[model samples]
Target: MSKIVILGAGHAGGSAAGFLKQYGFEGEIVLAGAEQIPPYQRPPLSKAWLKGETNENALQLRSSEFYAENNIDLRLGIAATAIDRTAKMVAFDDGTVEPYDYLVIATGSRARKLPLPGGDDDLLLELRTIPDAERLKQALGGGKRLAVIGGGYVGLEAAASARALGAEAVVIERMDRVLQRVASSTLSEFFTRRHTREGVIIRTGAEVVAVSGHSVTFADGEVLEAHAVLVGIGATANDELALQCGLECAEGIVVDLDARTSDTAIFAIGDVTRRPLPHYDVMHRLESVPNALEQAKRVACAITGRPAPQDEVPWFWSDQYDCKLQIAGLPFGASAQVVRGDSDTGSFAVFHLKDDRIVCVEAVNAAHSFMFGKQAIAKSSRVDAATLADESIPIKETLL
Candidate 1:
């Protein structure tokens, strides 16, 4: 029987392994990941896990018994060193060489390193792992001051959690607005307001120059003082192994619509792939649980001689303090945001339009709008902002 080797046991790697078996890929399937912990939900790590709202029991993605029953050769805590495309095998640090008929390059990304000079200590943390979250959680106890550098989702979430933990949290962002690059200014304003009302300090257009003993000095000569510092800027693709193998790589490993790489026998998914997305398309390296799992399932189907799954609008959600922010689709260069309710109430849906068509919808504390908007976006549903903002007409009817 031919062997199928999957690198990186996170959501994409592990999910593909299980689905390959579930879909009747009758061969050896081995899953490898750098982290020792099994594939668990990651979005919650920054949200629920940081707030003391989740336990270790709630983080398990699958029971150990399930792996045993499925006979998956699960290898954790071992990192893949390189891919020997010519040899058709994967080399690990442990001197183990696994030959494979099919190789899946799901080696996800790592937190983009902060280039600030000075004060590199073991105490400083990045919230990408269970161990990292534990350390952050412990540091979040009362009276701790956290200076979070970066105003993206992770940074904002960390700030919110730090505030909830009775700490003085300050967010330093290079962008002019929180989540400015990712969402509209309207949504950014709403989130910024939420963070401010929760007693979290935010500094937009601020850049960290250095870190020195509970203090982060900014380029503007402003110094931020804190007990602990958490950085959540973004992540860089873990493509050294792939790049060394001479695989086609851009900002990420380049993959086609089928998520297959330049080499048909090899494929990539998740945050590593430079998706073959067209103009006005935003499929490039989406860092969400849904994107990882969905692409993995598609790769599984491809490997199993089945049809690939259709690519839909990628969505993401975040839980901060007491509010849940759900995004329905990617809205690039969208012109209008029709709001039905007030941003203060946290009960509104922001409709994004492209060429006068509803391209995406963002909801806060509105689940029905999210569900309805998702279906509409999937169907390329055209609904005027006025009608979408009315809240009187059923959103589903807009799909027609």
Candidate 2:
């Protein structure tokens, strides 16, 4: 029987293994992971998991028996050290070698840490793994303070969670506004207002020069002391194994729509791949659960000789303090934005239009707008901006 080896058994890799079986591949599936535990959800680590609203049992993607019953050889607590593309073998940290008819890379990304002068690396925490979340949770509550070094989604989510646990939270951002890289200015302002209303201090345009123990020093000579510090600047793709094997890579492992890397026998997915957008001409590395699940289906179809799944409009969601933010598609080259509903009411949708067509939608507690906007973007339907912006008009009627 042909054997398929999947490395980095996270969401993408784990799901791919299950999908191959679901698609009737009739092949040997070997899923290897660096973590000792079964594949679990990472998104909740900064939200529900951190706030003690969820447990480990809820985080697992699949039960242990599912892999055993499915005949998948799930190897955990081992890291792939090198890949021998010529021999079609992979060497693991445990001194084991695995040969495969096909290989899937889903190494994912790692949290980016700032190199400070104080050499206090141990004092800083990150929320990429279960252990990291556990550590941070243990350090929170009882009026403890958390100093977040970045104002991205992860940072903001953790701040909200910290506040939920009765801990003070302060977010320090280097950019001019929070979520500057990913969100529009209006959304950023909305979140800033909400977080502030909830007693979270947000420091934008602040540069951190050093971190000493529990003290974070700013370039402008401001010092903030906290019980714990979290570094959530961004993530770097874990494409080192692909690079060592001489695969084509730019910012991440370069792959086509089918998730096939430069090497025909090797495929990459999830945060490790720089994949092409469905309708857009550009390629992007999207780090979202939706992207991982979509690419997992793509890899399974590619390996099993099945028809490729329909291209989907990329979407993501975040839950912070009773507000649910749903974003769909990229706002690339958008010339105008239309706001539906009212921001002050804690419910609204920002539609980004490119050439009079809906390109992206950022919806806050507006499920109807998000769903409609997502479908419109997928269909590439043009919209009447005035109709879309008018709260009196039904969302479905706004489409041209």
Candidate 3:
């Protein structure tokens, strides 16, 4: 009987173990995780969880009984120390060694911390784990003030949650506009207006020189004092184990479409992999839950000798206050953009077209537009910009 050992009990690792069992793989499965708790959803850590709208039980991916009933060896609170590729064995920090026929690395990503002079890094709060969320939640309340360092999705979501909790929030972004790296200028402007309307102060073109205690100093000789400081800049892929084992790595651990790494017996998945996109020639490291689940399925299929799952267009979603932003596909090589609805009413979609084919769509509080764009991108359907812009015409009619 083949035995599979999975590292890092995040969404990808836990889902991979479950998929293998569901696909009738009679192998010995061992899922190891450094955290004491079972796999849980991370998306809500900055929003619903932080706002006290959801509890820890609701965030779990599966109950503890599910693992035992499935006959999976679920090892928690144990970290993998090393991997011996030749012998196909994984060493744990608890001084135990597990032999495996196939190994899966799903070690997700970690929050990136900003190093500042005279700044106590320990005082800077982050929302990557449950413990981190608890700390941040405790710091926010009726009269508390939160100073967010980054203006990305996580930072903005936390700000919105803080406002919902009757706390003051001020977002300081180093870029000229918020969400400049991931979103278009139109989106930045829309979110900026929305956040400002909610009484959240947004500082664009602002650079933080140093942070001391609850005080943040800007390069322009401006200082802002707050009750708490949050660093939500970004995340770095946890590829140290793969790198130590001599796997091919770029921005992340390099993997094929089947989630197989440079070594045929070893597979990598989730936020730790730099995988090839479906339609594009470039490789991307996606951090969304959908991406993690897709890769998990891919690894399971590959190991179980089943047919590969169909490629899916990458998508992401963010909830801020009463607004929902759903994005489909990457806007790479797009030449034109069309607005489907009115932005003033807070229900709109931006369609990005490349050579008349729909490449990407950013829908705000518009589910139909998001669904249409996702299907269109999957089918590589061509669309007319003029028809897409005309709200009078139906979205289906705009497709060519």
Local accuracy of candidate 2 as per-residue lDDT tens digits, 103-219? 999999998868777635787898888999999999899779999999999999999999999999999998999999999998999999999999999999898999965889988
Query: Which whole-number lDDT from 0 to 100 does residue 386 have in model 3?
Result: 94
Per-model clash counts, in order, read 1, 0, 0
TM-score of each: 0.94, 0.98, 0.98
Best by lDDT: 2
Q: What TM-score does candidate 2 get on C-alpha atoms?
A: 0.98
* lDDT of predicted model 3: 0.92
Q: Candidate 1 versus the native: TM-score?
A: 0.94
Expressed as tens digits, the lDDT of each residue in 1-400 for candidate 1 is 8788889888788788778888887787888888888877777888789888897768877787767677778899898897889889889998899998989988888887677686465566788888989988887878788988789889998888788778889898988998987887878999899999999999998877888547889887877777888877889998888899999999789888777898888989888888854334654777778878888888888878888777666789988877888998778777777776678788888888885576778888999888877777776667766666776777765553
In model 3, the runs with Cα more than 4 Å from the true position are 118-120
- Candidate 1: clashing residue pairs, number: 1
Model 3 residue 390 distance off true place after TM-score fit, in angstroms: 0.4
| Local lDDT at 385 for model 3 | 90
Model 1 misplaced stretches (Cα beyond 4 Å)? 119-121, 277-283, 396-400
